[model samples]
Structures are given as structure tokens and as C-alpha cells.
Target: MLSPSSDSPADDVIRALADVADLVVVPHTRLADLTTLRIGGRPRALVECRAAEAVTAAVGALDAAGVPVLVLGGGSNLVVAGGDLDLVVVAVRNREIDYRTVEAGGAEAGGAEAGDGDTGPGGIVVRAGAGLTWDELVADTVARGYGGLECLSGIPGSVGATPVQNVGAYGVEVAQVLHRVRWFDRATGTDEWVSPGALGLAYRTSVLKNADRAVVLEVEFRLDAAGRSEPIRYAELAGRLGVTPGERTDPAVVRRTVLELRRGKGMVLDDDDEDTWSAGSFFTNPVVREGDLPTVRSRVADRLGVEQAEQMPAFPAAAGGVKLSAGWLIERAGFSKGHPSSSSPARLSTKHTLALTNRGSATADDVIALAREVRDGVRQAFGVELHPEPVWVGCSI
Candidate 1:
């Protein structure tokens, strides 16, 4: 409850959680060592659980005891603060899969969320444990000649965190294929599966993502057993696949193509590659009101040039809003790829302007400074506010 400012409190909290079965507890684990950005400080305690039940019990106990906690998966989408964070880290590590019942009938692919009905064979119902690596699952599904997750091929994180942020790539978002999510509700202290609708899943957000309200234990996804992909919705991917929008293709091909595209943009995780030392895109696409589009366009034309402004990317989004590319705005505002210099520990990714990377020795402050600069630059140039895509832990920009 006191947030473990001292070692005694950390030990006290760890001892309390350790009373539960099969929970491995460690003290003073550096947060940077656990995240993709590699830019956070140490936490008071860290508890890694091998089973879903253990995860649930550990989180529940910590919550009930009033101890602040962070439910960390692969730590891909997190941006934490510097110095010392004062919370417990509960690492979810349950990895199991049940791929029984491959049949020929009509069942939804990745379930109703994907917006496709049971078309060909009902498809295989593969439920993955929460802690399973998402890309690994995608690879397995593609290897088995199944189709569904190909569009999300190279996202780096745990499957459990997928639904949390409605993790999306190419043209596919997890909400489309997410059948259901099983989680341990810290409030009620009950572990159960709930429909996706209950999650309030929207673009890059869900009730559970940064809330720490629940810890996801497992996830169920419906895949095409006929070995075909879901309809291709992204223009780039569809073009590469030689198919029109809303067309289906071999799942393996889709995965390969998506991975290729992601690598080009530095969206895929590669340890040896400094370009991939990021938490993916740093900012969400700015959504503007339909009625204000003309004004926004005029502003862009005024700042840059009529031709350049006319060439800006704008797509129709939900609720009469138009989504504009954040990366374009950043580059146009004078922050090119690898901006600020080639020597800074924190800088724009050399491969993509949308990502802010930790060049092997950046701190949280360094990352935050770069983010603020980019966000402010975009706002000053275009009067559009860019929101960060990753969830912040113990830090704000």
C-alpha cells in the first residue's frame, strides 16, 4: 500500500505474494531490462508467475494489500519513468495452446470481431495462453496452413496484451479476431472470460490496457482452417498480394508480406538493429473533425506549399473524423528520420519518423524530451495534437 519506497516494504510485499504457490519473486529488477525501449528504472519488486492461476493470485493479493502493481507481458508497449519506480511488477508467463477440432463448416474467423461470418470450413479454434509471444503464435498459425493473424505478423509483444490495446498492424486489429479474453479481475478477485464487447476496445485502447484493472490470462482466436486469410483491408498489403481490398489469400503469404512491410518500417523487433529499438510508433495518427478538414488543409498549405499540402495523407475514420499521418507531419515539420543528430541516445528512428528510439544508452528523460519536442513541433506546425501510442508507466509526456 505504501508503494515500497524502501527495501523493507518491497520485501514485505514480495513475502506476502510469495505465500501463494509457484510464484518466483525477485527484488530490484531494472525496468529498462524488461522493456523494448530499454529506458526505465528499477521497480521495488518483480514477480514472475508460470501459470495463469499464479498470476491471478499474485495480482489479486498485491491489489488487495493496496500495493501498486504493473501487469507486464513482454514489455513492448510501455514507457516508464526514471530513477526508481515504486510498484511491483507482475510478469505473466503462462504459455499454452489448444488447437483441437479442425473442421469443415461455417464459423467466424477469429470470431465475430473480424466482421467475417463462417464462410468455408468453420476453421480451427486455437486458444492461446496469455503469455505466448504474439508473433510466435502468428508463425505457428501460418505454419499449420491456417489463415487469420497474417496481417498482424510481426508485432512484438505477448498475446495477452493484444486485446488490451486492440493491437493492430497492416489492416488487421486484434478486435477483429479476438474471440474472448480470460482475465483475473482485481476488483472482484475473480478470474473469468469476457466477450470483447465488454472490453471497450477502440483504436489502440481497451479498458484493461493501461488500467491494470485486470490481468489477462488467456485469449481465444478463431482462424481459418481452410488455410485462407481474412479479407485484405490495407492498400499496401492488398497491392503486394495482388488482390483488391476485402479479398482473401493464402495466410502464409499474407504473414510473409506483412512481416516484410513491417521490417521496412522498422516495426518489427530486431535486437541487433538500432532502428528497431523502439516501442513501435511513438504517436497515434491525428484524427480531425470532418467539418474542420478544409481549415486543416488550408493551414498545411500555408505553412508548406499548396502542392505539398495537397499531397498530405488523409483517410476517413470513425464518427466523421479524418485521420492524418503523424509521421508525415513530423517529417514536414523538419524532424527527419534520425533527427536531433546521429549521436543522441534518444532520437527519431532512422527508418521511420513515427518512432522514437533508445540508441543503446537513453534514459526515460531522454525519450520523454524527444517525444515532447516532436509533439510540440507537430502542434506548432499544423495545430494538430499527436498522442503517444504506447502506454506510459510511472511517466507522462
Candidate 2:
């Protein structure tokens, strides 16, 4: 007979899940090894799923037993608490990619012929496994001479997480080209493919965020096959590429420039660089209502001179609000790049004002303390709240 110790709740679930091919389960895994922050504690269990069926089977069994599941991807956009976590981590590892150009009359999901493909009036399509690194897909597409993802080239995370946050940068968002998303609906235990419209995508957010309503299995993006990039919208990118505002430049040029800019900002992941040991762009730029822009501008004018206020960076939000720079608010609020000091365990990235980084020995608490300090400080100075972009686990800001 088996020992009673051999059949605990997690073990029972794992045993039942073993029948699913390509799904592996291990107990007592540290989340610090799984997140970009490098500060989380160990989870009760870790499930590695290499295929969609394995993911569904493993998660379904865990959910049925009322086990808390934390779906982990590339771990680029997460912060988890340091200590014994009470949940199980589901790490997606499938990595498959297929390319298709839209054929005449808009073929069905599997209608297009498979090849290196091109973009044009009909558009190119890329289908990738949920576990694929986002930048890898972008690099592949651009290398093949595609252009739609140029502005978003250096972003870190999984393909599946893109639509969850409607990931955007340099004025380009995943929502603009997402065609289909295959998800395992947690609430219903159903797996299926749905159109992008079903996710209710918006600026840096979607239905999958915080709700834990579903687990994305794969993603499909439509791309420009004409070998020209989307219109250059971000001024900094345009200037670096030597293109006029709104001009369509080569995707390769845009990708290179964006990577350079991100590296300088410590937004790109660099294992050897402590400044990049962070969740890129810690705060999303705050968007104030249309009527509220003047109040903010006036505040800036009052604090710094009228000339400074006139030059403050502000843009019309896609949803009509006025988007103010979070970095600007942080700096004006007295938090400079590498705020606190180089000796502190948690400090602002010296390369960028927006990133809150871990200086090798930071506990989750250390990072949180800095985040709260920056956030509360910014609110007091500018009356604008800074919202964190990374997903927080077992902690709140």
C-alpha cells in the first residue's frame, strides 16, 4: 500500500495529470527562478506544459480540486512575493510557429498555404504557440521582410500574453493586428479559438487581465505583406529612423532603432546589466480626461515656468484622454533615474526614470517599497497616480 504522505492534495492532482502527454509536474519550485523580477518565493508545485492539450488537462485538474493556479509565461512582466506561496505555477513551454499570407477572398483560419509568405493588401498572418517568446516572433517576421511588428520589436513576454494586455509600444499595439486567439476558458473549462473582438481589447488591457477567466493557448497576428512598416507614429522612433512624421519606413530600420532606444532605457532584457533586471517601464503613462489636461499643464506651469509647461510631453490618447508621461511625473516629483542611491537594493534604473529595478539582493518588499515611494510621491507632486504595468502576485501596490 502507498504511504499516506505520498498522496497529498498536490500529489493527487499531479498523479492524475501525469496521464496527459508532455505535461510535467514538480513540487517545491521557486518562483524567483520563473519571474523577471527574480524575487519571488517557492510555489507549492510547478507544472510545465509543453503542448496545449497538456496545459488544458493540467489546469483543468488543478481547478477542479480548487487549487490556485498561477499561469506563468516568459516571466517578463510579473512580480511575485518572496515567501512560501500557496499556489501552483503553470509554466507554458510550447514553441511552434507557422506563417501564412492572406489569400484572395480571405481564406479560412487554415486556408492559406504555408510558406515564408509576404504582406500586401491581403496581409500576412503568423500563427505561433502561446509559449513562444514575443521578440523571437518579431525577429522572425522582420527577418522574412514583414513590417507590421517593427515598432513593437523588443518587447519581452510570450505571444499569448500580448492580447491579454493589448501590448503596445511606439504607437503600435497587438490589438491592431491580432486576428485570432486560442484560449482555454478557465470559467467554463472550454478550449477554442476566438476573434480579437471577443477579448474587448483596449490600451494595454483586455478581458484576460486579472480575471483569470482564461488561459491563452496560441495567437495569430496579421501583418503588412507589402514590405513596408505601419505609419511611424512615435516621434522619437521617427527621428531615429530619419523619416518624416507618419512615413512608412523599412521594418528592419525601425526594429534596429527601437532596440537601440530600448537598450539605452534598460527596457530590453540584458542578463549582465543590473539596470535591466527589472520589469520594463514600471508604470504605464497616466491618461487624464480631456478636460483635465489644462489642470495638469497649469500645475506644471506653476511648478516650473510657463515655457516648461508648454514643452511638457502630452499626447492625445487613443481613447481621447490626454496621456501624460509617467517618467516626467516621476522626475518632476523628485525621483530621478537611479533614485535613492546605487547602494540601495531597490532603485530606479539609472538608464531610465520609469523602471524600478532590483539591485541583485532585493526582496519583493524592497521593490514594493520603492514602487510605493515613487507612486505616492508622484501622486503628491502631480496629482496623477502611476499604475504599475507588471502583474503583481501575492502582493499589492
Candidate 3:
């Protein structure tokens, strides 16, 4: 529990937010309990808002008071420090879902056209509250025979965070289907809906990530009405579904196959599996300049032989560079799955090299140490710098 002075600024802000409708002030809540990593310490206080207006009210008050604030969603992509922190957590808890049908060739929902071949007749738009669980929304869409979101199945976190990180899996990214985002702009104190172009969406990041620019209140995604999944661009997924790449299949089958692949890599969250207790993927695939690719391949060949280096996974990134697999790099750098032995509190996940997991007793420091070791090892071995995917608070590697 926080025991600040009577006149502390946090206390004053709490008093000011007491009357905000649908906002609850929770004291002594640990970040560990709120995050999927199951590690972290307590914030000064937690402000849980149940509605969009309430979220705006609470966050606006904190911003006005100059109180340090952390806008928490599902806590799936956070790496927070331990000990009693000085920041206040504003939790978005609005859980509304609305589906609107758009007539083909009509005005698009959020100023964006539907996917290719989706203009035949009907298109579905799903507006989900920022606080709703991500997978829950995906399951709902698949259950109704809708497509578009099946490739992103089994991802943790909230709907609001999808655009923030441009969440993607199985070759599908949120930027491909995002209709519009309703956000509360911090700088202007105005609530408005903006199209995807307003967001600087990249491989795995956006303007909203790591910046306190705005708080997402709700998100809308376009869906296919023909009950067919998005074109399978991932080779592994397509091979498993017995279809060639770029072919569309059943949404249910895609969802099931994606889930299976995720579970095998311990990407899905499960209480019984310690390996699933992580911040999903710890590192983004490193994109190297086209000219530098040869140097990296030469280094790999010198150390790991020509055959292994030739088989290294390299994909053409949208930004004109070759994206190298971080997991493959980590393994080839001598950091195997469950590296540094079974006795360490924090180590590489037993199921996946890219995930840094907590063995029930790991601290933020433990995770940071292991992350540095792997990142530095890869850098030394291949000259490619690996960047962390999760947002960091009060700590860094």
C-alpha cells in the first residue's frame, strides 16, 4: 500500500477524481497482478475506468495535475519495474462491442476501403471497447463466420493496444484491417475518431507506443462478410492448412491452426504453463540493410557453416530491408531455448527462444539481465542490433 504524505500530489489527484462517474480508485494494486508477465511492483495508485468518458476524465485530471501516469490495458506488453513506483495507473475498462454492416461500394466506415475482393456485397465493421480482451473479440468474429481477424487469433492484450503496436501474427497486421480509432488526445484534450493514416503504423510500432500522446477509447476493425479468411501469407500456416500461400480458407480453420502454432511456441497465455508467462515475443525481427545482409550471412557462415547460414530465415520487409528472424538468431548465437540452465529465475522460455519468461521468482532485474545477454550476444555474433518489443517503464536493458 502507498503511504504518501497527507499533502502529496497523488492524494490530491485521487480526491479530485473521486467524483468521476464509472471510475474506481483502487489502492495497493501490484503491477505484477495486472500484467501477464506476472512480475512488477506497485504503483502509487490504480485508477480503473469503466467507460470512455470516465477514462478521459481520470486521465485528463491526472495530466492537468502533472501526475505521472501509465495508461494500462491488458498489461500484456509491459515490462514494469519493481518497488513502490511513483506513477499512477489509469486502467481502461470499457467493454462494449458493436457490429455495423457496410454496403459494398458505399462510403467506407472509417475512410478506408475494404480488402481486395471484399466489395462484392456486404462488409462488417466491429467496434470494440478499448478494455475488451483481444482474443475474446477474435473468437466472437470467427464464431459468427466472419474472417479478417482469424490470423491474429490467440494474441493477448486489449483491442485498444492492437493499433498501438500494430499487432500481427500469421502474416496479418492490424493496419491492414483497422477502420478507425476513437482516442482521447492528451495534448488537445479532445476526443475524436481518426483513420489509420493518422497513425504512423510500422512493422510493430506506432505513434501511440511509448508516447503519452493519447489514450485509445475504442477501436474498429473491418471484417470479410464472405466467411473466408484473409489470404494466408505465412508459409508455415498455409502449409499446415494444406493450401498454397495467398489462398483464402475457412476462418475457423485458420483460427484453430494459428492457435495451435502459438501454443507450440508458448505464445498463448495459460496459468498452468510457466513458459506462457511472458510478454509474448521479447524482440522484434531485426531489419538489416540490403547491402549489410551479405556481411551478416558471412559472419553466420564463418561460425555456423554454410548450410545453416544459407537456411537462415530472411523476409523482405515492407520498408525495403530484409527482416531476419530474432528467434533463429538467438538460437544460433548460443542462447538456446531455456538457455543459462534450469536454475535461473529468468531465462529463455523452454518452448521458444524469443520469449523471456519468469519462473515465478524472477525480478525485473533478472529479465533485463537475460535480455541484455541475448541482445549483446546476437549483436556480437551477427552485427545486427535487436530491439525489445514490449514497452518499458522505470527500467531498461
Candidate 4:
């Protein structure tokens, strides 16, 4: 049983996969080439699987051979250590999409249309292969007058990564639109489609997150066919679209606004912009106990005065917890945007305090050092912990 892991000495596996018409094995590619952060080490081998069967076969063979595998999607939400990583990269490239309009009273999508404006029930269902770029999906839906994904516009990464993180922005989460997911279970080596309930979807996390238990093959999202966006919820996004809270607007309008807002913050990827050379937001908003909010509020009021504290972004969370903005906390903790200096290789994005960027020559060590500094600084100032939002490989905070 040969695997493609060169370091594992999988020459036999490489030879075996050469006969696989659906799997293309590209040797000697670095993780840096595949990831957004532009930092990472070389993998043992890079295997591109363009179909479900190819993916199933590649992963199964590698897993059975006792070789560690890193499944690469858009590589937008990952941070890998520099140097030679002792693992194989199984990159999923199977991209196919099917769209259907679900007529009124003839569809089931985990309550997606239940509270979607007042457009009366009917919606659209898009079944997209996991490898499709997330923003591309959003753009297509908006172009076709379909809604539900507009709020998530400008988010980097692939469709498969969405359900894994329940990726959200502008008050819309993938959990809200996600209806079903087709996955390859590693344990049983079987393919199956499961509902959202089975995924344990939550804020920026899901059952697949950090589990390495299953591979998402495809995803199905329920959208509003009436071309209306999901009810405007996030205040900032609502204001930009000129819609009151809970009011739905044109999907195109929402998409354009979201992209503009993202660009302003350097959240959208731009090859010429170093500020965009980041893994999006560095940390998730810290969700804390409700009873603990006042203490943190006082910390804010103490440093920035009462007026600023009152305006600090604080939202309700599950179990009466309060979600505090990580960006607000970082800036308040003395880590200003572009902290220290702009000449440094690894610095916070000038446009957004939340993004820790690579100024062209930063290494894994530089990123880790800066991330630790920000995380520790916030904890020391507010006594609240900041958890990283990206998946770290061969590194830890």
C-alpha cells in the first residue's frame, strides 16, 4: 500500500496514483503556495482530487497507510508553520454546483424561510461542491436574484469550510442558510448527507471543526428566491444598506455594501496590498458570562471614560453570556492598528485592528510572536481570553 508521502517514502503510492485519472499529484509544492497568510512549510506531497471518488480514495489510502493528512480547501483560514511539515496535503478541487427553486410549501430547509422577511415561503436551494470559492457562490446567487448568502459576501475560503466554521458576517451565519451537507466519514469510509442538527453548528464552529473526523464533499444552502436579503440584523451592515433592523432588502444591494465595507477594512484579498495578506480576523469575539460584563465594562470605562465604555460593542450570547469585540479589546489593550511600526514584517493591518498581517517577509515565528503579544496583552488588561479564529497547524497560541 504505497502512499504519496515522499518523506514516508510513498513512491509506490505515487506510482499507484499516477494511474488515477481523477487525482493529480503535484510534487514539491509548499503550503505557502496554497495558504492566504503566505507562510507555511513544504508538505510531503500535494494531491489534488477533482472528484468525490478521487477524494475518497486518496484520503482512505493515506489514512490507512498511517500517514498524517492535511485537507486543504481555499487555505484562507489556516496558519501553518514554516519549514518541512511532516504531513501530506490532500487538496479538494471537485467543484460542481446545482441550483433549484423550491416552490412554496414544497421545501424543507431547517427553517431557513420560516422567518425570512414576509415573502411567503418559497426559496432556492443551491447544492455546491465543497471546493467552490465562498464569495463566488455569494456572487452567483446575488447575480441570479437569489438571497441568503449576500450578507456573507467578501468572506475568503471555500464552501466546505463554511459549515465547518458556521462562518458569519453582517449578522448572517452559514448555519442559518445551510440545509444539508454531504460528507465522507473517515471512520466508516462511507459517504452520507446529514442535516444541520447533526453538525452541532455554533458560532464560528461545528462538529467538523478541529475534529478531522469527516470531509465535507458538498453543501446545500436554502435561499430566498424573491431576491430579498435575510432580515438585516447586524447594525453596521444594516446601516450601510439603509435598512432598519429586521427589514429585508435587495440581495444585490446587500452584496455590494458588504464588499465595500470589507474592502475598507482590508478584509478582501488584494494581491498588491500587504494589509490584505492576513488570515482575516485573528480572533473570535470573546463570549463571556453575562454577570462578568459589568466588570469588563468598568475596565473599559476606567481607561477610555464612561462614554466610550457605553459604546463598546457588546452583544448577547447563549446562556446569558455577553460577546465582546476582540478588535475593541485589542485596540484598548494598547495594540493599536499597525502597532509598534509599519516597517515590521508582521504587524496588525493598518485598516483593521483585528487582522494580523504579513508585510511580505514575515515568517511563522513573526506571526506567532505578534499573536501571542496581542492575546497576552488583552488578557492582562481585561482578564478575558482571546481565542484565535484560524486553524493553526504545527503551531499553538
Better model by TM-score: candidate 3 vs candidate 4: 3
Worst 10 residues of 3 by lDDT: 112-121
Q: What value of lDDT does candidate 1 attain over all alpha carbons?
A: 0.85
- Which of the numbered candidates is closest to the native, going by highest lDDT? 3
Query: Model 4: runs farther than 4 Å from truth?
Result: 1-11, 104-121
Task: List clash counts for every candidate, in order.
Answer: 4, 3, 0, 1
- Model 2 stretches with alpha carbons more than 4 Å out: 1-8, 108-121
lDDT, model 2, position 272 = 94
lDDT of 2 by residue, 1-397 (tens): 1222344576688777767799887766777777777788877778899999888988888889987889989888888888777777898888899987576655634664332222234677889999999999999999999888889988988888888888999979888777788899998999988887789998778999877899999888888788789899888888888889889989998999999998888888888989988888889999999898888788888887798789889888877898889998899888998999989999999989999899899998999999999999988776788899888888977
Report RMSD for candidate 1.
3.2
Worst 10 residues of 4 by lDDT: 111-120
The residue ranges of model 1 lying beyond 4 angstroms of the native Cα positions read: 1-10, 102-121
TM-score order of candidates, top first: 3, 2, 4, 1
Global Cα lDDT for candidate 2: 0.84
RMSD of each: 3.2, 3.6, 2.7, 3.7
Candidate-wise lDDT, in order: 0.85, 0.84, 0.91, 0.86
Q: How many clashing pairs in candidate 4?
A: 1
lDDT of 1 by residue, 186-232 (tens): 88888887878889998888998668688899998878877889899
User: So what's the TM-score on candidate 4?
Assistant: 0.94
